[model samples]
Target chain A: MMYLFFLTALFMGWSLGANDAANVFGAAVGTKMISFRSAALVSSVCVIAGAVLLGEGSSEGLNSLGNIDSLLAASIVLLSAGITVMLMTRLGLPVSTSQAIIGAIVASNLFFHEPLHLESVSKIALTWVYSPLLAFLISFALYAAIRWIINHMRIHLLMIDHYNRILLFIAGAAGAFALGANNIANVVGLFIFPFEKAQVTLLPFFPRLSTQLFFLGSLAIGAGIITFSKRVMITMGNSLFELYAVSAFVVVISSALVLLLFSSQSLSQFLQHRGLPSFPLIPVSQSQSSVGAVLGIAAARKGWHSIRRGLLLKIAAGWVATPLGAALITYVSFSFLSLFIDL
Target chain B: MKLFTGKNKMLMSNIDSFLQLIGDSSTYFHKALESYLSSDENTFTEYLKKVSVIEHEADELLKKVKHDLYAFMLIPDTRADVFRFINDLDNIIDSSKQLLVQLSIQRPLFSPSLSDGIISLVTVNCESMKALIETASVFFRQPSLVENRALAVIRCEEKVDAIGERIEREIFSLESSYSLSEKMQLSQFNRQICSLSDLAEDIARDLIIFALKRMV
Candidate 1:
């Protein structure tokens, strides 16, 4: 019976992988610099490593949002978020799974009369707004610096081409690792409370049951990447303004840096140790960060004229609509499920 | 396998071969024009055939360049720009072939008075083409020098334009026994040859734009 509830979390993990993997290596695959098979292999390994090793940081904030003691309610929330993401994806809209999950959790809390963690919720909300803005600023500065260095170095065009290909691979790997570290929380963070003491070692070599669950979630993400990310990668690679190899490199790296900044617990602690303000470890949207990076580069190059305003407006609308739609869906679905099941 | 491994060297070699073929085609055009002026029918016919063959070879090289460009992952930054540049350069070869063919079909006689201006126009246009080729080659080898080399092409084009206009004026003022239709044919020939230089200048402008993009 517990296994049945776990499937919803796996479904959510799969949806996150299908949609967010493109944010990591879309341009490289789209430009035909890296084959789709090679990208999938690298992304799978890195995402798993990241989730197993460093996925805990942002979950602290996520867990604080609302703790649902009931497994049935948690499953409903996950299912509602997954279904909302799937619906939005079919509608050709770019919605963040992280945002959808948060909204679903909030709605579930309200429905059950659970105490809302207002302070943590507000902190997570602030990071969501800051994440994209920071990504844009970092990308703008990084691209300008790269452009300066290219002009100063007087590198041959062929040599620059070779260098960009290598750099793109490195950046793609970094982005994948960052995606796993930051977004694994969105996939499995909500269930951690109920399963906190439930430990089952699947393999003799493994540590505990929680690690196993995280591994399973990461595997689902890997499956999503292998089976479903190709079309989204192509759209991201070609539909956006014609990204030169250099610009593509800058965008990927800057977005990865933003994710790492928000998700790295060690970095946050180090800042606190130094008497500096620590960054909130929130599970921000990788899709938003990637789009922000592109917009930053575009704005740096040619201001508003270079950006696709209509496409961006549609994305903005999707961002606002995703969470609200997921919350409403979760409310309705949970009420319907309560009628049939003893919650 | 060889094409995949050393793509930089292969693209450079292909570009070199394409430039060599274009130069050969331009030379054949000059020889054909000179033979026509000297009234050597057999030599003119030989040069026309040579120009046609060289143009065909150049076209083949262009096709290979395009095929390799699409097949292998070469320079991603400038690949599209380079592809468009090659297409533009291909036009010069086509114009050279068309000019030779026109001379062969019409067989327009040039008065001795107009001969010097006609040869000068062709000479200037060929020189412009040669400079443009050099600039394009330099663009691939050393992008920093591309802007400087492109300036030479611009200067050569100015000379071609000036000489072409003078030749047109000379054709209209001819006091020899020529019919109105013959004069019109001569004027048309002058325009066609001059059009080659204009094409070169247009290509040079594109090269400059490409170079500026690299600089940025």
Candidate 2:
């Protein structure tokens, strides 16, 4: 029964991998700086490593928004998020897995009559906006600095090409790692702590059940990358960003750094110890940060006018629609499922 | 790392060799014409053969560089610009070889009195080509200097234009010393030689644009 419910969380992970992996390596593959095969392989491996190793921070943050203590509630939340992502996508409605999972968790918490952690919820909400803004600022400075360094280096064009290929590969890998580290929480965070006592001896290397769950979730994400990410990498990567190889490098690295900033527990501790403002560890949208990074490049090339107001409106619309759509579906389904099962 | 760096260096060397051949072809074409004007027919024949060889070598280098560029998918962003620039640069050697070939076959005796004007035109044309070569060589390494060198080509073309007009005057006025057919042949050579500097100037103009568009 538990294994059957676990498939929903895997579906969320798979959907994320199919779509968001392009945010990391799409430009590289589109520019032909990196082939799709190498990109998918490196991305799949790094995502799993990041999820198993550093995915705990955001998982805790996501759990705080609405902690689901019961197995039935946790599985229900995961199923709702999975359904919302697929259904909304099928209807051509804007959706993000991060937003969908949050909405589903909120609905399940309401249905169970559990207290909401409004402080943590607000903090997580703030990140949805701040992450992209921070990416814009970071990439703006990064692009200018990189452009200066490359110009001053006076490298030959062919040498620049060779070096760029190497740098893009590294950036794409880092972006994948960061994606897994931050977003893996959204895939299976609710289920991680609740199932900590389960005796699962599948992996001798990982003794903790949370690690086992994260490993399983990341495998789904990895499978998604291997099976379905190529078309998205080719279509969405360059079409959305339209970046040159150099701009792609800057955009990817900036977004990766943003994801890392939010997901790394040690980095958060380092900042908190120094009396610096540490960001709330949360799973922000990778696709949004990538867009922000691209906007930063556009602003650097032209002025602020380069940012299209229409696109901003669409983003705002998605921010509202994705979560609301998921919340509405989760709420209605929970109400209906309550009559059929004893909770 | 070493593998890619080594490939980049080898590609750079191939490009350098190609550009050098263009330079050598222009020089040999001018030398062949100067020797012929000075009545050193043997030296003219040798230099004519030299220009032909240099042009062939340049074509080979072009083919190799293009093959490597596509095989490795290098400089994806700027490769099209590179392909265009190199193709135009090859035109310099092509035109030079054609001029040399025509000079070898025609052997139309250029009079000693008009040698000074004709030699002046060749010198100015060579100067224009040299400026274009300098501009192109630095295109990848130092784009900032490309526009400046391109300006120098323009200056040389202006001089070539002025000198070509002066030579035209000298050739048409030589009716007393030569027949009408001889004058017409001399005029045709003058037009063709002056056209070389025009080609150089056109390529130089495009170099400025290519330089501006270079990705760092």
By DockQ, who's the top model here? 2
> Which predicted model would earn the best lDDT?
2
**Shift of residue B130 alpha carbon in model 1, Å:** 4.1
Docking class of 1: acceptable
- Fnat values, one per model, are 0.25, 0.47
Residue A34, candidate 1: Cα error in Å is 2.8
Model 1 stretches astray by more than 4 angstroms: A86-94, A111-113, A150-161, A241-245, A304-324, B1-9, B20-56, B73-81, B98-109, B134-159, B175-188, B205-216
Over all chains combined, what TM-score does candidate 2 have?
0.92
Clashes in each model (backbone N, CA, C under 3 Å)? 0, 0
Q: For residues B1-216, could you state the per-residue lDDT of candidate 1 as single tens digits?
A: 221366666766787889888788888888889889989999999998998888888888898888877776566557888889888888888888888888889899899878888888888878988898988876765667887888888898888888888988888888768888999999999999888888888888889888877654
- For model 1, fnat equals 0.25
Clashing pairs for predicted structure model 1, backbone only: none
